[model samples]
Target: MSAHQPTQHVASYYAASANPGPERPSVSGRVECDVCVVGAGFTGISAALHLAEQGQSVVVLEAARVGFGASGRNGGQLVNSYSRDMDVIEAKYGEETARALGSMAFEGNRIIRDRIAQYGIACDLKEGNVFAACNAKQLEGLREHQALWQRYGHDQLELLEGEAVKREVGSSRYTGALIDHSGGHIHPLNLVLGQAAAFESLGGVIYEQSPVTQLTHGEPVVLTTPGGEVRAQRVVLAGNAYMQGVEPRLESKSMPCGTQIITTEPLDEATARALLPNDMAVEDCNYLLDYYRLTADNRLLYGGGTSYGGQDLASIEAVIRPKLLKTFPQLADIKVDYAWSGNFLLTLNRLPQFGRLNDNVYFAQGYSGHGVTCSHLAGKLIAETMRGESERFDAFAGLPHLPFPGGRLLRVPFSALGAWYYSTRDKLGI
Candidate 1:
């Protein structure tokens, strides 16, 4: 951890390469709206846009700048699904629920692409996402996964074994792989900023540098911010993990865990293509998986290793550099251009929690590190729910969630122990 903490976006490549946008003013006076969505990341921005386009008086209150949180600092891989694969849902919640979840899994990708095209947002969107299998067990899992997702009408999946995997990745590490042609990647920070721009174009209001200090639930929900207050017919707590002390009830339902990433100095186009010839983003199947992809600027963005209990290391470079070298040993001498970490809310159930704290106060969080797509989906669900159409929202709320066994204080220790077991299983190729 740095001696002085970072109150803005972590020192990340995304922050370094963020789009040029005017800084928004903080909330300063009383405001009223049809909907007040806190946190201007993916879920909040998407919800604001959806609600605003529907002619709802939407006001987005962001503690930080647009995409300043995970929306800005993620792996930028659009994996086109939830963190909980359908098979897991099928086994745990039956096919009806699995079908409900699967139907909306890829819709976020559609919304993202649609917004990009409609607004002409320059987010460097790319196509294709490769799922690499690190061992025989993982390869078998991919085989089963291909057939499983196919049963759910996902025909865009193509499984590659042995030489095919090597040919696609330019790496012999993965035994086989599954490439989702329907899935894609993008400059995530730019994507959210674009979404914010789209939200603004729709006449939605956004207040930045305005952290919510208190929430008083009533006929019109009241949000107390440092500079102002907002009373709305509906309120959305979209802050996710960064929402510390904002709402204890929301905080109790999910634990904040962290993931870190490192970006290499930009490579020559030839070298970038050589490393990932197909230009597809890749994520492995390990419990603590490594995700990587080539940037629009020809940089290799590599990241992995999860801190289940959430950790802030003195040097993120020290924690992630070795992880990068392990994946591409030939790049051991490559200059590390940027290193940063961000938190995501982790639920005990691993499924996202979407429900209301009470009537008119809805919340959607705990994507379990799958925020890229699901968060956007949550935004859609929230908008639909706010409009009194809760069918889709109810489907996700149908997934069961339990509070951490020992509550907030002990959740990290409990989770750390569980992570130890699973990550060991990952190392053992189980």
Candidate 2:
């Protein structure tokens, strides 16, 4: 283990408002379970909850604390879609499979809502999200997206014109928007914490401060931590960007990218309403998007931009605050309260990677920037696969993922250059 442990959670607005809860026990001595999960983020906790509910013995091990990774630090927009656009899916897999994938993506949001309701998780769930377009070109793209979703039987999305979009989002930056009624936002950290608590209440065991350094796959997989080990019938790797040398093959398929976020001090309810009357989450249609929402206590939680290779929280705040001001210059005098950054994994194809290393070792990751709702759906599919029903799991497992072009050491640099090119094109309106 490193001399200094990573901070257990980012200092985001979500963490500050999270429910007070008991810390999970650390793994001590050798233990065994039916399934041993590595990483206590949403995917792991959600899977453990479902597996345990089915009376399976499940143990979840976390390097830091639950929700300490992107699960806690994301933009919190639960948009109902995969990272890949519908057109790309259609181009790659043809219309039928693409439509099926789209429907599954749609169900992802419902899975999240159902879990929240069934587990009684209080995460400030809100309705509606707008994907706003900044330019005429992007407006046309948004219209195409709305049509594609409608073709796939998801007609909940409404196309808002330029003036209507400005009215809806209070931002003249957007020329038009696509409003998805099912898309929404949540206090993500609290959602993860609540899921962890619910998982524990259902007799699932969670071990914190435990990083799996080695895995020996067989009839029962052996997972070794610094202080302890777990031998289980099945292993699920939900670590995503934080897997960190545990699996070399899986590591090459995804790279960690850092994203930054900041929150303003609480505004009066009237001021908050002025900013967003419907409390709908809003994200621009830039390749490098900016997403923001209003908190239950009326603070503006804004997340935008990414730092390719490394992250400096202070610098991130400096860059992001101006972007926030650009969206709502009315809050110029308000104080900025929280700023933080976390790493999320992205696949080369911008699609999730789910497959079995062997028969017993299953991994699900690479949700790109769309993990919030997708992670819940992934958990459900993982649980179902473990129970010998593999249809949904196979759907994602069938997607092809290539290793990063530059190998592990140079992948970050390569990805940084590629992202810069895309961001440049976005700026150039190409």
Candidate 3:
């Protein structure tokens, strides 16, 4: 790849099996809109779609092809809450804020499903996801979590203990599990592309390969790009980890960490069902969790491990294969068909950072790891703020997020050190 070569989706199962989509034109000349969204990933496009549907002119600026970032290449689990659970948020903030945030905890998944239904998107959307527990302590934690969520009027949870977990997951690796029937997975890239197309149908425009290099503050924010400039009354920095140096203050609030995944060659129907009989996406409760699910073609997509500062390992398969075998050793002879890594923004407090830099400029990032749903919810909150309804957005903004211990240059190593401690505990099952 050339130094200045435009970015493309990483070679992964999603990219290899991506659905057909029109090659949207790159940004050229001047563009104006009511809201200019930077980053064409889930957050940006989600914001654009919601704004456009409400009769607002929107423009989406993407540095690469759509869904070319973590949004497209994630573990594909549709977890229904933020990275930090509702009870944690309630403890840190208060009941009022938690109530507001919890109420929309599951809306993001609904929006994705609704769009798939409305636009006839063929993303192999599936229902059901499981939160597996690795040890007795984590299992107990899940039991408490299930009860807490019920107090908030969310009772779509079923607890599976020991042998019960084996019925849902073929492996006996887990002590227990919490099955969320409402949660599910999807072809994330296709879900994003479908949303972009739906945005276009609502008169929205998306400019691929157009990355904002500078933001000039004024009446209408002027976002400069190599090929084009976007001028709009309000602007959204939805790039998350990928939005580096665009704004100095915003960059200070989060660290970019890489997570990896690998997909096995297609498995026979009996084998696939035997692994995940219920077809539910599964993620464990380890400090560094292992998440896996059966694909539409019956291949196992397993992912885990974290790299700070977005430094990728020489071979993702080398790092993840051992973990896969430890969980499902029966597949010792199985071939790894695909492996890739993507970065997610992590805040020190483990909660998403949502706020505005100044009037007319909004941003949301640092989902920690629960972005598939929270990012979509962030878009709706941003739209509501632009529409002068700031209550919901303020609820999230009020949640405090601290900058990394050392600034951006040193935060990566500092976070890695902290992660090492937690990972050690996971190893000792402490």
Candidate 4:
């Protein structure tokens, strides 16, 4: 791909099966808006849609297509809470701060469902998800996890053990599991695309292939693109991992890490139902986790493994195939229809970093790995801040953001080493 090549969606299952969407024009001439959002991923679209619904002149600029990043490429699991759960937040921050964050933890899931209903989106929305435990220790951890989530006002949980787990997931690998009835999955690309359409319906303008090349921060922030410039009263940097060169301040505190996914050829209806009996998403309890769920078309979508520093792996299939077989060896003959990778922003503390670059320039990134829900929540919080309801936004903005221990150059190796240590412990059940 050329340095200035026009952006396109990655050749993933989501792209091949995505709903038809218009190819919007890039930024041109001098554009003005109440809010100029950088990046057209989930955060940007969510913010733009919310702002537009409230009758604000919102302009969203995308270097590539909408949902082209991890927003479209993720496991599609609507997992709740932050990458670091509420217990970690309370331990590190305080009970008050944890309470504030926990109150909004499950709100993202609600927002998604509401949008789908209100706008009549067709994203194959399914319900329920399982947290599978691989060992006795991990099983106990699920017990603790359920209790923790219950303490935080999210009580739609059920523990599965013995044959009960097998009824939900045909695999015998899980010693036990926790099912979140409210948690679920969807056709992520369609969800974002539907939201984008809704935003446009509300008079929100989206500029595709328009990467913000230069950002001159001030009261009326100016964002310059190759074709034109946009002046807005406030700006939101929602690029996440793809925002590397656009802003240096965000790059220091976060690192971009790649995750891979594979979708199998459409399986027989019986086989698909057998894999995920109730059609709920499943994620293993491991430092290097494996998440999978059956797509709407009866294909198994499995994903896991991480490549730090956004380096592309030689073969995504090679890394994920064994894990898929380990869970269901009977599917050894199943052909993978698609394989692709996407990058997500990671923070040192495994929490999201939400703050301001200056007075009117705000950004929310570093979802670590639990971005599907948090990114939407981030957008809502950002809009709330702009509407003078900064209490919820301050809960995140007040959290301190520390740079990677070894800086950007060495953050990859350092994080890999830490992952190795934790993964080793997970293996030993320590």
The candidate that achieves the highest TM-score relative to the unseen native structure: 4
Model 1 misses residue 260 by how many Å?
A: 0.6
lDDT by residue (384-409, candidate 2, tens digit) is 99999998889889888898887877
Model 4: clashing residue pairs?
A: none
lDDT of each: 0.87, 0.87, 0.89, 0.92
Q: Model 3: residues >4 Å from true position, as ranges? A: 1-6
What residue pairs are clashing in model 3?
none
> For model 1, how does the per-residue alpha-carbon lDDT over 184-293 read when each residue is reduced to its tens digit?
89999999998898889889999988888889999899999878899999999898877877788877778888899999999998778777888999999988888999
Residues 83-160 of candidate 3: C-alpha lDDT, one tens digit per residue: 888888889888888899888888888877877898888888898999999888899999998998788777899999
Clashing pairs in 1: 1-313, 1-314
Candidate 4 structure quality by residue, lDDT tens digits, 1-430 = 1265438999999999999989999988999999999988889999999989778999999988999899999999999998899999999999999999999999999999998999999999999999999999999999999999999888999999877899899998989999999999999999999999999999999999888888998879999998999999999999999976888888888899999999999999889888888999999999999999999899999999999998889999999999999999999999999999999999988999998888799999999999989999999999998999999999999999889888867899999999999899988988
- Candidate 2 off by > 4 Å: 1-3
Which ranges of candidate 4 are over 4 A from the true structure?
1-6
Summed backbone clashes in each candidate are: 2, 0, 0, 0
The superposed Cα distance between candidate 1 and the true structure at residue 391, in angstroms, equals: 0.6
How close is every model to the real structure, measured as TM-score?
0.97, 0.97, 0.97, 0.98
